[model samples]
Target: MENKIAFIRQHGIRVRIHALLVDRYLQTYYDKLGWFSDPYEVFRDIVNDPDKHYIFKSILAKTNVSKFDLPNKEAYQDFFGVNPVSSFKQLSSHCSWTGGCLLEKLERAISYDLPGLLSSVSKAAATPAPAKAAPSPPPPLPGTCEGPGCEEKPKNRWRKQ
Candidate 1:
């Protein structure tokens, strides 16, 4: 259990770092092209084409990084051994690509203090709802008597004899 927790933390850190690196790389390329509309889509287009894959691979290689270095790469391989890159490839296949889905997958791969979130959620769920204060008795109506079993009476207006 402890080992799993440690791996999760490490995975989160690596994924975050990788995200920053990918964003920086994409931004730089986008800047060079004078294109600024949507960088992730550009990145997706680059990744999806075999011709462009070389450029993408060059960019990655220049950074001295590998897909294998990414967190959960093994899990990706284990789960989708036939096409480990398919997970990333799908990012481009979609009509609208934001890179958010990729980030989410990475986030989920790592626990990201999930235990803390769960504990806080559990504490909130376990807490009693302050008993609702019993809805307090309604305020007495005007001209009403102020004793138990009392009812409203008309105000006396005549002068006392």
Candidate 2:
């Protein structure tokens, strides 16, 4: 019974780490696109894309679970009832939960249990804030008429010839 409890705890930690890594990977991927209006929509699009999905699966397969104190893929699959690919996708689906996103949970876990991972992710995603671009010159200052065809005319005044 003690061994079973230990195994469960170990498995939970591994699952949490795996979820963290997946969230980091997805955030980096979406960040490269400049802007994503809705993170959930982008996530769904990425998950639906066969090529992208395969790449994500490959990342999971290549990542060293042992470093996170988890068993190898085959063993994990045998014990968890699902392969790493399926497990990753399932966890990622929970990232959009209303209570608290999986990434937020992962962040808290890392902050408490694995500060190094949290620091690494923060450094990796720390992009310089894009320059402000001069606030776009504040439009045209009402209706001053600056365009090519914009002619200056008196207010409500008509020409009589």
Candidate 3:
């Protein structure tokens, strides 16, 4: 899976530098906050961050980044005979590409304490909801005669009375 993700990182229009940086930062942050044992686990938690939001925006816009980031794009090209290099080059050269912006923010955000945010989020998520009290047992039926001196009675009848 890492290999596949790495391949996507290489060819996808959305540069992964920012996502990777954020992921690394969030992990350390989560760990320091006592939310996670290591920095690696922040991938699942920080996936909803701005990096992913940028990817979603690209996908919604049907931009070059979205086209390039399709899962198994290489296989798709092999089956369809479409070249990816031309599109990749165009996207790389685009003046206002979101990928470029994402990369820039990732660089800027690197110095900031992103882990603190992630740690707070992780702590909130880790907190379990309060358990509901168990239901009370039902009361005994009236006139059941459960005392020690009472004789056992047959269902719906009294014996030889």
The 10-residue segment of model 2 with minimum total lDDT is 77-86
Work out the TM-score per prediction: 0.29, 0.29, 0.24
Q: Per-residue lDDT tens digits of candidate 1, residues 21-87?
A: 4454344445434445564455445434423334435435655445665434334224333532323
Tens digit of lDDT per residue, candidate 2, span 40-138? Answer: 555445544525545345544755344435334444324333332333443456655467676557445544554554455566668677777665566
Give the alpha-carbon lDDT of every model: 0.50, 0.51, 0.42
lDDT for residue 70 in candidate 2, whole number 0-100? 36
Worst 10 residues of 1 by lDDT: 83-92
Clashing pairs in 2: none
Q: For model 1, which pairs clash?
A: none
Residues 1-161, candidate 3: write the lDDT tens digits.
44443444354333443243333333334444454454334333333342443534444363223433444423422422343221222222333654555444543343333444455657777898898998997886897776689868566565555
Rank by TM-score, descending?
A: 2, 1, 3
- Candidate 3 residue 27 Cα shift, in angstroms, is 33
TM-score of 3: 0.24
